[model samples]
Target chain A: MHIGALHISGVNLQEVEQKVLDVAVNIICDEKGKDYLIVDDNPGSEILVLNADSAEGSKILNNASENQVKIVFSSSTQSGKNIITMPTPVRVIALKNVLIKIAEQLYAYIISKKGHLKAVKKPTVLPEAQKIENIFQQLLQIKLANKCSLISSTGLPSIYIDGVNGRFITEKSTDDIEKYLNLDFNSVESKEISYEQLNEYSKNMPVAALNSILWRCALACSNGKLLPGHSENTPVKLTSWPNFSRHGFKPDYFKLAAIMAKQYISLMELNRQTQIPFKEITDFYNAAFAVDIIETVTDKSKLKKTGPIKSSQNKSILKKLAQRLGIN
Target chain B: MLQLNTDKIIFTGPVGAGKTTAISSISDTPPVSTDVNTSGEERKLKDSTTVAMDYSYIEMDDGTKVHLYGTPGQTRFDFMWKILTKGGLGLVLLINNDHPEPVKQMEFYLDSFSDFIDETGVVIGVTRTSINDQANIEDYQAKLFERNQIFPVFEVDSRSEGDIKVLIQALLAILAN
Candidate 1:
């Protein structure tokens, strides 16, 4: 039995089933369809081979001739008695097992999320985007509800997202927001005003000073970490990922938590004051949470602890635990 | 019974120049203001925590309902100026005599609404006679004439409700003519 060109380095047959399962078609060698070639005949399979420089090597050609796999190669070879005319590198065929696995995983994730793989079109609101934003806002609101004793604005629609935990409100009519919510927005007067002159004036002001004001306000209102510069949020760690920090994706949970905490405090503070307009407080809170003033974290962790974590206000509990452990 | 429709007129000027007091004198009801304590930066613009803007409904005897918007003195909210001027028929630019450069303030409003004034006439309202002694309201009136073709300029105390109404009447007359 002559083995033909059996060089496999980068190909992981274990995941091959998964990668090509959806695209791969089963081709039965016999009429009964019982025994299949289990071959990945999909055009997309070409993505597997990143480079074929080594396959053009003379040694590899010799290896193929010895294997007697009836090599019909792509490249012209100088020597080989049994070697058929060559046009390209010897194609290494694999069992259909890996492609099957890829198809299974893809369908499983799609089903789990109730999502169907569709080509993304520009300017269209994707359901997945709304879902992610909803999850983030819910997490922030839940965290803030527990941590802050008071919230400032009443009759205002605002959502807080964790990882940036920033409060975003529609200063414009809730028409756009209602479209996203897929519901009618309650009628409320919009009070947040943007002064073109003032906005431009602030742009001329020192960004560092503005950041300092934002940090100080957030710190004074509640206990939250003032991250270094703007890009210092904790990175998100997903459990199923192949490797940590793969492709440099970081999640900023701390900044998100801090922003929500401040918004909760500011809203509550506004509510406490009878005469102060709630809209102004909302604007201040928004200014503080502006992306330019804060940063996000990029380091991801492997721990997948779900559920509402302890509120930021319950630092005393941690302190007590520290005392019990005799650690300061 | 002559039914008249009143358009929203936003009076924007420096703080202590009495934007709220000016609009309140002519409005049927007290204006809703977002007033708060002056932060360190705002104290320079306002004697106290001056209101950013006051919204009041004005119903003309002719059944014309107009809204009057008064902005706070601090330049901090120049952003809100655009929103207030979005559909404004015209602006009543109030100038305070107490400010060393009342003309400069008028120029600021004009520059802010240069585009708006291009489409609609701006009525200049000068408040506080004491500060106007050096050049008087007439000097500013001349300034307005030089800058605008249809700009209506007047001298009045924004503190008195009736006197401020006179200014609105002047704006109405200019708009009517």
Candidate 2:
């Protein structure tokens, strides 16, 4: 349960380190032990905390070509790729979470170095239809946990039973949805809804709820395996921008997806580019696919190269002008 | 009376969005600023506020002069927003991410200049993102999408000439399209 010896060093981190050590019983700050290192400008530490705006932080980061060190930057802004940054006036919860992640990484490293790590056998794959059903059941579980009704927006039970529709009308008001539901499912004994039917019903669900269901479906359909159309070798592109406003998705999710879809790049390539967790990226892609916002493009020609503008000449002029005005 | 035949780009946003700083960063000549000492709550943030407007200019390689006009940030002076936008080729809206309600501010400015945005073009430069990460570039894009508008949004340090240039280039690209 003990996270190995951790060292803490940084101009801004003195108080933070004291507070963290007081609360985190497992983390030990020791200079003698090399299991885990936390530093600002000092090299050889596993975790580097640097002030984003300070010259010292910049100098250290520039000189850090070391491999296998997890960098944690203390800044007032959001953390970028590879490094985990805690906002200034660091919160105890955020620090604890970062430590937990570091502990997991350390455990994995130790196991690999000891050659004790073994590959687990893959589970038997379920039929495509059955897999979708499994996903739908999971979605139901989520809705139930959230105290949401299993009934579709159209007032019919989302989960069909036998040949008749299940009768659990959560909302008694007879609106257009109720009328449509009654006309569509005349009989009560309808079997389970298929994936396509679920997708169609999604249009009626609130954007937030629909996004949740779609994400769950993607996870279930893929069965923890690479999706049929997605792979580490193939490049993926966005067919269209996901209506984040309508979908109630965080715009950041769409931006990441758009960046990946702009060019044909494998998920691994995207991982390298963004340094975001592989699982998170795959989950987002799966959700995007379920909502029909992205596609796999075999033709490389279709991939648009929308890189940043090359401004070597312009940059020089701007730099000189900025220096003159003391704007840098 | 002599009039300068120069195309202009209007920079407007809520208070403390760094419009004046951005103009000063890229302006070839010293900016003509009408700033007054602050006496109210705004004084807590800065010592001065632009009362009227700030003006500067840049000369392109082809000798085309592009005038930069910065509108006063407070809505009390919003009467000048339309006046400043007149004959403007595009709008550069700089939003301060540290503001309590950046998204709301974004919507207000976008709606305020919707007609101008539609007629010409608009680019958003979010300043102080390094200090405030609550509203990132993607969040701005989402807000724009809600209004059924598509515009380029960049995270910029208004004082950085390179960062401002990137924003200006994005605006130019949008105009070209």
Candidate 3:
């Protein structure tokens, strides 16, 4: 099967052509003739990017067809001449090389099957949750009015994110919903129902602010990556702060938030300043982004070097107080 | 280990804003309050009010004591407001969202404590936001933005110790930054 779209698992795909590294992405492969499914976890993805370090790499590699360029995140020791293996946390330049390789392979395969197959559209690659985020984003933008219910494979109660009221309508307990926020949406389809139907079912159900679910979901599914538009090299600041009281606190979230509110710094630079883990910082970014508070720095000239933030006078006292309050 | 009064945090806002409850939430011991029955217009909102202050302390493991002082909310107690804020590290301004024009109340507090806020910093705790539909966290932020103010604002319940700590933690974080 020619790389119609992409299917991904594990590794967070980097951007190609300023879009996510999904193969002929956003376009659905409607017809199925056992042609090929890169199928692992990615919903609309055709290319299957596996971690070469993972045992599942070789097994899935063998399943890929000629037109499909299967990518593996190779470790320092691993090497394969016939297959594509880029480093983990693939650099932009390396990702470009892979895109070139995929293009060549796709063109050759298409020439071999001229007039046999149809064409598909593609965009920057995205993880499964990013695609799901697109739906929530449209709801936020007021462009999408489709009343839908999200159903997962686990047979849990269906959850409805009511864009109208900015609430979640569900019979499921908030605790249960939080637990499954990192839900696999590959096979999960949001059953679009009528507005009347949603109202009838949601009348008596427990409701929560939709931002709470979105906030936690972003944290759960971020997979240590920022959204496609957010560049790792670009600094960011918050236009508004997350309502931590409602969203529930993650450890050190306040610290990262303090920095975000005060300075415009990239995640890497923020990590250096605060000494908080890079992954945790990205998780904070995802949550902040999902809550719609994060803003990328518009002017590089406005970015200032973050100096020491600890108060000169109350440094000791603040540390003591933070310690007593269990935040230190 | 008890090191007395290295720094103090001032909790202030309009009447019924939960300063006393907030102080008690993170205090090491029961707060000492000079609460008395409310009079005239204020009495309609609550039975009693703090005429002076609510005093509490947080003691570190090594005996450093950070003080917490809650100012009386009524403007008539403005004399004690200045007195209580002295030697303070920052302010925790709690606004009762259920009050008519809670954002206005915040503006009043910010104006009253503008000097103290400038010297230190302030974190706002918008209490009773759930009970009030007229205002949300964004409205408070919008007010701050209009005033060219940048401060952390949280939707909080003064009764929740965790919520109280977050406010204080955010205050500390802001000061550090």
Candidate 4:
């Protein structure tokens, strides 16, 4: 019997042709929903055929509509699909007859689903952009040219830095420093201070690395955005590692720093590789840039994804193990 | 019963870096361990130490299993690292942050398993920072940077299940990377 187009999934085409010696079944290939690819409903039309012999096939089958027909040679059960099970040692003619019938049903199903469709919008949460322009960037910018001790303030809410020596003095504790750095850059101003005054201010105070303090400031004040010059799309690597131990870091920072230092990766690529939010990767870049650990990567060939490749079966097994151990 | 014969993840580090403890924290079954009393200066740090590989496995729901093997931390057993890592998935190198030169010990392991790591991948877990706090994570990362290599180093308390799990997950993630 002549049949119409079919988006046949979980079935082999060559085996079907070998079975149906004389019947011509037009196949329309598509990468979309396995069953919906064939839309035409005529006496004879094009069709798409798919076979569920592997994990990828199972994925397509699982995503298929519950109403559409599912044909399987093995005795495997799909959750909701109308499965037409065939024994493993079935005759060739039986397979061809099943295909013809399934193709006709799939076409009629498509014709029935004329304009009923809905767009699925995925929900995404983005970090809010900070309202204030920033205070640390201006101070850090002047740090390059001043060539002397620079203090953001003279009193308790202050930062004492000697960039040349890599020593910094800050009265603001770690918890309060972010608050102080978030203030409007226009309102507060930094001034050049004498070394004598810097020494006196640092008395009984712990002298830490300037980047140790500024790394925290850069991350907090940069507001989920990268500083100019370093594009997210172009690859860059860290010349030196960020001091993650000295201060608290977002979890993604570890992977980002490791991946970037291992090889040149664009910030966009970093986010993609690590599955870390783009905002967090941007913040990491800003902090790394402030610490002078960033270098432009001229050779693009150095880019190779770091991580193990696994088959879908192994991936599921890993997921199950992670869940059983409560590691997720 | 079906068994995954080729799946293995190796754990190795210096003496008293908590290699055995890290394995116990993540393994589904109690890890079979072999340890002996420490002598000389090593005795000052810990009472005993692992002298051979600790073996354990976690059976996934679908009957697939991931085997965990922790090598002896003593330098004398360096030959076993390669044997244990043959056809392994990745390496988890634990370093005692309290050690005088934890970075050096880390370097030793990294060098010892360089070929395996180049073929597979590795994750570092820094244990016992509260004891002495001599070494830091940045120092380890800097050394890796200097060596032109990079791996995730985390401050992990080997006794804490969550910490060891995170380390394993990091190793698995990079292995998957």
Query: Which candidate achieves the best lDDT against the true structure?
Result: 3
After best superposition, candidate 4 residue B104: deviation in angstroms?
Answer: 3.1
Model 3 TM-score is 0.68
CAPRI class of candidate 2 = incorrect
Better of 3 and 4 by DockQ: 3
Please state the error at residue A111 of candidate 3 in Å.
36
Predicted candidate 1 versus true structure: per-residue lDDT over A214-248, tens digit per residue: 23333233223221121112322111111101111
lDDT of each: 0.40, 0.54, 0.66, 0.61
Tell me the lDDT of model 1 at A127: 27
- TM-score of chain B only, all predictions? 0.83, 0.93, 0.94, 0.92
Residue range B1-177, candidate 2, lDDT tens digits = 002422777889887999999999888887788898887877766788887888888876655566889999878999888778876777899999989889789899989998988776677788888798776554565455445345666678899886776566555544442
After best superposition, candidate 2 residue A17: deviation in angstroms?
32
Clashing pairs in 2: A163-A189, A163-A190, A164-A188, A164-A189, A164-A190, A165-A188, A165-A189, A165-A190
Off by over 4 Å in 4: A1-132, A136-139, A142-156, A239-259, A268-277, A298-328, B1-6, B27-30, B56-65, B97-101, B128-139, B160-166
Candidate numbers, best lDDT first, in rank order: 3, 4, 2, 1
Indicate the docking level reached by candidate 1: incorrect
Per-residue CA lDDT of model 4 for A1-328, tens digit only, reads 1222243332442464323322222121211123323433331233323345567656655665555565544434233436554434343323443454454344544455653232211111112243335755653554433223544543436767664334566674544456567565665656766545666666776566566666877777777776643468977876555545444576566567656765677887777767889888888887777665666643345566333444443455555766767655
Choose 1 or 3, whichever is better by DockQ: 3
Clashes of 2: 8
How high is the DockQ of candidate 3? 0.21
**lDDT by residue (tens digit), candidate 2, A33-118:** 23443433454545555455566666666565455343444443322334544445544333443454454455556556765443
